[model samples]
Target: MERLNAFDIRELERLCPGGVKENVSLAAISRWQIGGTADVIVEPSSVAELCSLRAFIAQEGLPSVVIGDTSNLLFSDEGLRAVCIRLGSRMSSVHIENDIVHAQAGVWVPFLARKIMSAGLTGAEHTCGIPGTLGGLICMNGGSQRKGVGSSVVTVESVDTAGNICHRSVEQCEFSYRSSVYQNNSEVIASAKLSFLSGDKLKIRQEMLSILAERNRKFPRKLPNCGSVFKSNPAMYEKAGPPGAIIESLGFKGACCGGAQVSPHHANFIVNTGVARARDVLTLVSKISRCVLESVGHHIEPEFKFVSVHGEIMPVDEMLKGFFYE
Candidate 1:
């Protein structure tokens, strides 16, 4: 991995112009609010700008990563040391044409859900409370109520590491339960066109509101935390229970390791108590994984992705493999 510096920042500025920022706080951008400063951050306002910047990065053989909202990610205490390309508010745009929706990668999932609902769309109600961007949701096939956003996807557009644009249909996306082909590739999701069905606007609004209220009542709201810590496996659910229920049954609810604690409201969530470090969260995760595997004879996998200081990202469970309870 290549480390960015003042010289690299200047070159990046020339490549993308006004979309460059330096020495940004990772904690400020991350939902968990618990990381050190990032050396450089770039927010491309358009696909052209993103392509130019990405091409420059590839030409220079520099370390780079793409992120949106940071809702399900955890960064190291040492922070990110590469060029962080953030697709966010500047790139957010949602266009509705009848039952079809064209949404940019940065469009917030909840906001997009509401937009679809207001347009009499029914398939998006399940996403009304997910706190990630459209790109992240698509990559993870994320949604509440066991319904995935991938189900509504018609076509997806992405930019590869070499700055080449690619398009794929829903079938080509290879979406499964909480998984997608993007998880196995280096492609950056740019935008997507989703298909929906017509419904009563009033009925859609009521359902979305009801889902939001239930989420608000069930999840912790006062602290900084990523949504769910563990992914619920279908086999585990049938044999034992959901991740939250299984964790709670093991007396791990409210369990704390330093400043990080398993949320009392939802045992599957690990909340930062004002001063939690990345290490603290990892400790609690290891404890949970080890205890569950030993007690219930099943391994619970993490839903969160861990971002290392070197800008390498991987599933938290994979990173902790063979090192649990250390």
Candidate 2:
């Protein structure tokens, strides 16, 4: 609370009105259900309010972090000492005009996929079961079946650190396997304009159902966990197969550290057995990385982002560079 003075909270309340909250539980917001409290949480109802809040934070030099659905984030056990700006239900809006779709950052991926499918759009069939928001999905260029959302991205709108809205074409996004320019920048995504091919609704629905069925058969849905713990490297896949298969070959399935366990169903997922801590998850990540490196001469990157107490977000593997040697 030392970082956020009473005056700051009052000002934030005035800016965002009913969207501001104090001492909110991060565990309740995170997919892993494993974080401590945050001093302040703000959900801007409109792009205008978000711009104002961003400007104020920049002007006052306040520590702040923006999150979408929190589906791929692992927050610290120690409470965050910054303002948490969550783009969620308030900002989740979708509009479609012919084959073009405009969606806000907070629209859930699954819901967005259904909307697109209903509109008879073809490109979003792969995102039908992703448990995240459009902001995070585009930030990570995420999709299943080796297809990325970047394929349909026509333009992206984001708010810079200075609160200026910026628009960029798909090329400027620098989309790659499980990454985008947003991952390395300070800008927060506001919305996106995407183009899709016209398709038969029945065919699209069948494709989405197939993908969902395969996911359900392979993934652990009964437990609380981030979707994937390791990024799938194309080169590594050719050399050693996918991360899940490799981790399973190394006997890591059902492995446990504190209350965190390597999912018995999917080797790439680390699940919370009711009570888990950030340290436990990181320990498992470090152990998995060490094993992978020792066995395959490949350093697998993590797909999940870890948010520290200071609001700094980094990949678990990057944070554990020294852990490899120790």
Candidate 3:
């Protein structure tokens, strides 16, 4: 690990009163339960702390990345040199104001959905079963049943790369199927406002339960995994059916590589059965992608982001190395 300069250490201390944890295990934080360690992992207690930390990193010329729950992320075993800025628990708050719900980025998605439903508000029911932070959902444009969170998003507040706060309306966000303006932009989402319709408590609860039950039935609760591996490409789905269906049809379900395997219930899900590595997950993903392309002529793109040991973004092919090795 590279040593932090005295100035950098002082800056980190000044910005995040609580000193950052060095060489924090990435496996412990990510859903995949795989990867090496982050050189520096800082949990900022408040928005101001986050802003200050960003400034410190910039001034120190250190690489940094902001992450939420690490649900849909794959990190290399070689570890990371970047300072990972995770929003502290203090940011996980959800508040209701009439028909709108304001949620901090660190708030869990399922919890946020429950809060909205408890307030007798509808439209968040589809998110009842998703696992991720509200900020991650917004960044990924997360959705189910053809309705995305962005559809209900009225406004978004984020911090740009320069630590400047920017507020944008739904119209300005440029939301697509499973992506938003935030996907490529180096902005960090702080909070969002979602609009909902008034509904009966019983009706909303029932809807939430139905979605939850469906997800539970399809995804195994015991295994650790990112919810879905590939984005649903409607065009590809129309031409060759869904990615899951194609992979399952090719007899890839229950396929195992190291500790990672494609779920028997849902081929789209690659599970970590106790001790899987990031390499194992990427290998499984590559095999599935190859099989899907050969069988259905569709190249399924992965939904997760791959971070390398050096804090550099990993290429899809490099991340999938050793996937075909027996």
Q: Each candidate's lDDT (Cα)?
A: 0.89, 0.91, 0.82
lDDT, candidate 3, 1-326, per-residue tens? 36666666667877887747776888887888888878787777777777777766776677877778888778878778888877636588888999999888889898888999989999999998888889889988998988899999999998876777889999888998878988777787888999999999899999888888888787777888888888778889898787788888899999999989999879988898978887788778887788788878777888888887766554466567555644
The model with the greatest lDDT is: 2
The TM-score obtained by model 1 is 0.97
Q: How far is candidate 3 from the true structure (C-alpha RMSD, Å)?
A: 2.1
Candidate 3 overall Cα lDDT vs. reference?
0.82
Give the true-structure RMSD of model 2: 1.4
Q: Who wins the TM-score comparison?
A: 2
lDDT (10s digit) by residue, model 2, range 1-326: 26688899999999998999999898887889999999999999888888999999999988889888888999999979988989888899999999999999999999999999999889899999999989999998999888999999999999988889999999999999888999989888999999999999999999999999999999999989999899988889999999999999999999999999999999999999988999899999999988999999898999999898988888777777665322
- Judged by TM-score relative to the true structure, which candidate is superior, 1 or 2? 2
lDDT of 1 by residue, 1-326 (tens): 55676687888888777888878888887999989988888988888888888888899888888889899899989988878988888888999999999999999988999899888989999999999999999999999998999999999999888888899999999999889999878788999999999999999999989998999999999999999999988888899999999999999999998889999999999999888889899989999988999988898999989988877888898778665443
Instruction: List runs of model 3 lying over 4 Å from the truth.
Output: 312-326
What are the root-mean-square deviations of the candidates from the true structure over C-alphas? 1.3, 1.4, 2.1
Ranking by lDDT: 2, 1, 3
TM-score against native, each model: 0.97, 0.97, 0.93
Candidate 1 Cα misplacement greater than 4 A, ranges: 1-3, 322-326
